[model samples]
Target: MGRKSNQQFVQIPLAKLKERIKQLCGIYGIRYVETEEANTSCASYLDGDSLPKYGEKPDGWKASGKRIKRGLYRSKDGSLINSDLNGSSNILRKVARNLGIDLSRLGRRCLTSVRRIRLWATKSNLTLKNARAFTPGS
Candidate 1:
């Protein structure tokens, strides 16, 4: 049999992809406002609605910052309690520990990467993944 030749593929523009990524990131408390253009667009989008300001900062930005900070802090502390590991820098290590895996067996070099940390935070079924974002009323 011959391979089908009528298959078609659609190409999405980078700008469109970026916009979609920005939207998804927003839902996960990641602000893509580091650049001037992004900041302007974000500001405009936010101003268009009467959304309640949780504080002097946007909830998403604050949450992302908190997670980063927690992760870094946990990396420094040997203790890995659920609260401490909520958004700690060594989240993968914490998760492994929580699961009763021996870190020594895995070797110190086998800790999870940042990308994996994000994946765990966003997709893992672990209890730590259920930690609420540091937002008001959360």
Candidate 2:
């Protein structure tokens, strides 16, 4: 029985994940859109390939390995939603500043508690839906 339950829990359907993504974006007051149809590349180099030019990693050089599978979350206020940083660090910082929530304790922290951010969101009235399904640090 435990094995069966584990097997069932091992995979969450992509549809459910997408729905969760939308819910999460709604909480952040951001537009959630998966632009799978768009064939675009983010590039800076002339050859359209960004690599280690000097045989070493440059400043802020971090490899996420394969590109993170994330949905596009945009806000009119220009907030960003990054999966690597626990949803949206940009929004959190902005909200914290506005609400005077001291986050210095979490130095260079990307991931933040959902409760904290949710409280901030609630205070700002970003969404009307009751946020009960979100867990901490989601």
Give the Cα lDDT of each candidate: 0.36, 0.42
Instruction: Name the runs in model 1 displaced over 4 angstroms.
Output: 1-7, 33-108, 111-126, 129-138
Q: By how many angstroms RMSD does model 1 differ from the true structure? A: 18.5
Root-mean-square deviation of candidate 2? 14.1
Best by lDDT: 2
lDDT of candidate 2 at residue 127, scale 0 to 100 = 42
lDDT tens string, model 1, 1-138?
Answer: 334643455566989888899999899986454222122111211112222233444555421112133333222234222223332323333245445544343322223333233333234455554555544696
- For candidate 1, the lDDT comes to 0.36
Q: How badly does each model clash, as a count of residue pairs?
A: 4, 0
